[model samples]
Target: MRLDKFLKVSRLIKRRTLAKEVCDQGRVSVNGKPAKAGTNVAVGDEISIRFGQKTVTARVEAIRESVKKEDAGQMFTIVKEEPTVEEEQASSNL
Candidate 1:
């Protein structure tokens, strides 16, 4: 499935257009490389999204067109976040 569609179907970004916009601006990556809206996404792929104040990483567990809200938690698993530049360096210097 397309990355944009997967983000929406998985309830990651909420809207497809927003996903496309964020992707076009290079705020999204798949498997550690930058990805575009049309990028193909499959199971087990890692997806990272950057928002203004936060970054979210999730590993794709399954792809589905529609899923119940109660079952949305089964779609993907959240991974450890990348520490901000300052925090990372600070920790390393500790």
Candidate 2:
């Protein structure tokens, strides 16, 4: 699935246009490489997303065209989330 579409279908970004903008700005990476909105993604790929003061890192466990809100979290496994600048800076200083 395309990165933007997957992000939307999986309920990560909440909107398709925002996903594209995020990807375009190079704030989204797939498996450690920068990815664009049209980048292809598959099961097991790691995704790192930067939105505002939060950074969410997850692994795509499964992909679906549509999923209920209750099942949204199941589509990907959140491995890490450094949601604050202070925490990120602290970690970076390690």
Candidate 3:
């Protein structure tokens, strides 16, 4: 599945267009390499997305064309969630 589609169907970004925009801006990476909206994703691929001061990493567990809201969480497993270095520094200073 496409990266943008997967992000939407998995409820990672909430919307496909936003996911694409994020990806296009180089905020999304797959397997440690920068990825685009049309990038192909497969099971077990690690995806990291930067959202402002926080970064979220998830491993693709399953891929489907569509899923119920209740089942969306089953598609990916969050492996790591951490704030960026700048965020950590700001928090430490506060």
Candidate 4:
């Protein structure tokens, strides 16, 4: 499966074009290495996406040409989510 397609089908980015844009800008990584929009993705591959000051990492759980909304979450497992240091510090101080 292509990285961009997987991101959209899994509801990670909402749209394939957005996924492709992000990937092209080097904001997406697979298995710790930067990946392109058309990079091949398979089950168990770690995908990390940067969204501004936050980074979300997930493991590919399954791949399908299409998925229902309810089943989209089943496509990947969130391994970790790191927020900006400012956000973390603010939360801790609250």
lDDT of 1 by residue, 1-94 (tens): 9999889888888999999999999999999999999999999999999876467899999989898878877889999676656566777899
Instruction: Tell me the tens digit of each residue's lDDT in model 2 across 49-81.
Output: 987788889999998988998998999999998
- Give the alpha carbon lDDT tens digit for every residue of 1-94 in model 4: 9999999999999999999999999999999999999999999999999897799999999999988999999999999999966678888998
Question: How far is 43's C-alpha from truth in model 4 (Å)?
Answer: 0.4
Which lDDT values do the candidates have, in the order given? 0.89, 0.93, 0.97, 0.95
For each candidate in turn, the TM-score is: 0.85, 0.86, 0.94, 0.88
Q: How many angstroms is residue 10 displaced in model 2 relative to the true structure, after the best TM-score fit?
A: 0.7
Local distance difference test, candidate 3? 0.97
- Give RMSD to native, each candidate: 2.8, 3.0, 1.1, 2.7
In terms of lDDT, the best-performing candidate is: 3
Of the two candidates 1 and 2, the one with more favorable TM-score, higher being better, is 2
Off by over 4 Å in 4: 84-94
Q: Scored by Cα lDDT, where does model 4 land?
A: 0.95
